[model samples]
Target: MNIRTMPVVAVLAFAASCSAFAADSIKIGVSGPYTGGSSPMGASMRDGVRLAAAEINAKGGILGRKIELVERDDQAQNDRGVQVAQELINKEHVVATVGYINTGVSLASQRFYEEARIPVINNVSTGSLVTKQFLPPEFPDNYIFRNAANDTIQSAMIVREAIDVNKYTKVAILADSTNYGQLGREDLEKALAAKNIKPVAVEKFNVKDVDMTAQLLKAKEAGAQAILTYAIGPELAQIANGMEKLGWKVPMIGSWTLSMANFIDNAGKNGEGARMPQTFIQEPNTPKRKAFIAAYQQAYNPPNGRIPSPVSAAQGYDSMYILAAAIKQAGDTDGVKIRQALENLQEKVDGVVTTYDHPYTHDDHEAITMNMVVMGQVKDGHVVYANAADKANAVREKASGKAKK
Candidate 1:
């Protein structure tokens, strides 16, 4: 070849090599309780995130680069959550953040991200504190976004379902002392008043408490015909068992987190006949759900190939997809830009739980809604759709006339 042709070929070869060698991996930080008391819920978060990262990478990834999830075990502690988030933001230098099931941990760590200007794509923390920036004069331009349903919105739906749908005259509120449980109780009260109904009792318990007999007895004495609660992991099972042991057979409601497999396996038959609002439930036959279930089974199933908490896996999967979508939309991995893209997500996200339509916005930080939270009852050791739930939803809509548009 001529010298001129050789130079041109070398330039083209160099450019091609650079293109091929250009790394496309963008790191996203995932923190949850991989150990300690909240491990079941944390495992779900971790599994879901891994599956999502895998799916995105398999599909050519975001911006021709693969997505990498930097996972850490927070052990469900506020201090640990904060420390892990710092490592992700500073040491790992991830483009964005996700995970953290406990609100206390999420709240504790949010300030750091806000100051660092790194966006947090929160999947599990439901405390209104995440939106503390959006309140009044403190409106933040960008910082936090959530894919999971918030307690206020979910609890309001629970109360509406119980009073308007279930037609229960008297209800009880049983919640842990944490922000999640307390907010759930408060929202239920407001929803009750809005519908001209009242809860017969509102009781509180700690996260470590195993015996809720006294609390259940108090609620029963107050003429509570139905129970609505917000407690994570095995605590929820303990409450269900306590209620059944006391022979209270009324309809019960709680957070979608109760759908975790551990809660059902621990509560066993007692968990049956109980109802909880959920954003995603494994359906009959869908490619997405099937793939997720299959992956989880391969990783964590027993000799019988039985899996415990599929909900956690589903959440982790969906959260990662949502984060990837935001990153793709941004066309760059800057945390602030990604956060904006998430808030302005206008397209439909085919999540493991459901198809999210215009799920987030500047006006609303909480994405999932009552439509996302379908009421499911434990029947024959599986969570099945409650009978006539659609009819009840129609009644709720007619009664409330559409939640302020």
Candidate 2:
């Protein structure tokens, strides 16, 4: 062969080899903040995703191809998350993604996936707007789906817990400045409005703000019988500590972030009795949950053999299984096909959180709803059902829901 022709043939051969290697494994992007303040949730979620992938790959893999996770730590920053999203889509060519611990990060990064038609299963981000960013009037297809409880449901639960259950007429709203916190605060307001109650004071604090004296003082002055929060673990813990300093002990009812290990550990006894919505507690009430807890404990060996963030870990594990089920049903790794399969999953996916069956639709993308969520309280360094009544109510609600057989 001619020398120039030989170089061209060699390049072609290398290209073919690259294509074959790519086809041998399915790349799924795992993007989350593996460090910084949100690391408890992010790291636990990532470990859960890893565990699910390992389990699937062990069972002859999905559709005869090994699952490859391309993990990128967004560091809980929106800009960094955008960069990771672009890299995962344009460079790594991941068919799907399954991690977003931060709402701002998910909102900023998921647009790229929507544009590229890549499916993103948000396992941890609870911003109400995260899944609804792309709609029919503006866009024909939405590539984003969520397995965690959205703030809408969580806010309603919080409101009910405070006003209806605890009978707190005066409440104050405390939220962080980020998109997650702010949006959750708004949801809380709307939920309160629906109940014909207004917050005594609405306060905002930036992330990493150790001193919540001003916020708590305002709430105290306003005679807030309850302090409703919509922030992450670290900041929430600060609020509990600040309240302790101010000698103000009010019922802390808020979003699901209260269940995070960072908050529990940082706030210590001050964080006790903080109620929040939880999709899954660490307790193994079911066979699936027991197995998942054991697997996660053996895999990560977290403190006291408890998962750091049980809700995040369980949601992450279930998100991976749901995505894998979709891929298997689709019988291919194409993003559009995967999205369609996710929207129309025929088989029931028994997840650690709940058994998912047709969890999505063309218009609605939220998989977990209010029915699956239960009120949990921090007790003795762990989150558990606040009472037997709440647990019984949650079980009855789940039994009455449309969970597929």
Candidate 3:
């Protein structure tokens, strides 16, 4: 028989025969920044996902199937993310897809997956607008599921910390004009209003702007005792630098975005004392977290390069497993079924960040919520717990309230 006339099973065996993972080969897709201003996050996310897939394979795979990751570089562009997502769905025939950590990229490609019936497990995009805009009629399948906490839950947690715990009364709001920033600011506003608290000063800036001294000065002049901001790593660092230069010292709190390793290193000593919520903290090593950190450190050191943010890696790692779990639950590997399985997931997975419980649902696409958020302060260039007692209180509040229930 001619080689071209070989049976489909023979062809698959020939393709995977060399690797010895023939009977249990499963393909999945991961798309992210890969290149661009956000490459640090993208690359880290990629490493995490790859690491998880490796571990999964080492353990005899999932349900007798070995996982194969098909990576696509979106370069942080939503349009590109959409194109790449389609490619993964149509060409690669991926069972499920994860990533597009940037909110813009996630938002741009969300509808594409919905139409194609491909489920996406978003690792890090936190813009609440995604959960709002692309729901029900827009995407009946609600194919979008996230491994990160939503802006609303994070905002509510931050407000509670600033008011009830930190006793911060005159907060100044500084947010960039991006989807994540805008959504976080709106959520903050609503949360504060519920507590009958008002901000002392509200300042806005574009994400690309370098100088925030004027805004910091305005907040200082307004007697702002605490600063709550919504912006990316670079801009957040710039704000911290500007605040120090202006000799303005105040309690700082904001979204989990600031916990990224780059933010602290870029901000230098000024970044110390900055309190931010985080889903994963790389300290006080649990066996699982320690193993993950060691593998990542090994993978990207010496002969390898350093990863920009370990948190992104954790996000990517967790997101992949969740997608895999959903795929397994669906059994057939059809996108629509996998998406529904993701929405109705019930089993708990021990993610690098934390153990996520019922990480997804139909009414709520936000996987990690307020209760999963932990407060960390940048100390000695490392993110450490901020007053263990206070952290406990915040977690308790999140649990007792809407977050856990």
- Clashes per model (N, Cα, C within 3 A): 7, 0, 0
Clashing pairs in 1: 24-65, 44-312, 48-316, 48-317, 49-316, 261-308, 261-309
Q: Residues 95-141, candidate 2: write the lDDT tens digits.
A: 99999999999999999999999999999999999999999888999
Per-residue accuracy of model 3 over 1-405 as CA lDDT, tens digit each: 211132334323332442454544787888888775577788888878876776666565666787777778998776788899889888877777888777777777877777777777788788877756567775565777777777777888789889988888889999988766777898898989999999988888986688999899989998988899888788888889888888877877998767766677789888888887777776525666666676666555512233476668888988877777777777767777787788777666777776666666787777765666777787877777876754443322113234544
The reply for model 3, stretches above 4 Å from the true place, is 1-25, 62-65, 137-139, 302-307, 389-405
Best by lDDT: 2
Clashing pairs in 3: none
Instruction: For model 1, give the 10-residue run with minimal summed lDDT.
Output: 391-400
Which prediction has the highest TM-score against the true structure?
2
Worst 10 residues of 3 by lDDT: 2-11
Rank ordering of all candidates by TM-score, starting from the highest: 2, 3, 1
Candidate that beats the other on lDDT, 1 or 2, i.e. the better one: 2
For all candidates in order, the CA lDDT equals 0.71, 0.86, 0.74
Q: Measure candidate 3: CA RMSD.
A: 7.0
> Quick one: ranking by lDDT, best first?
2, 3, 1
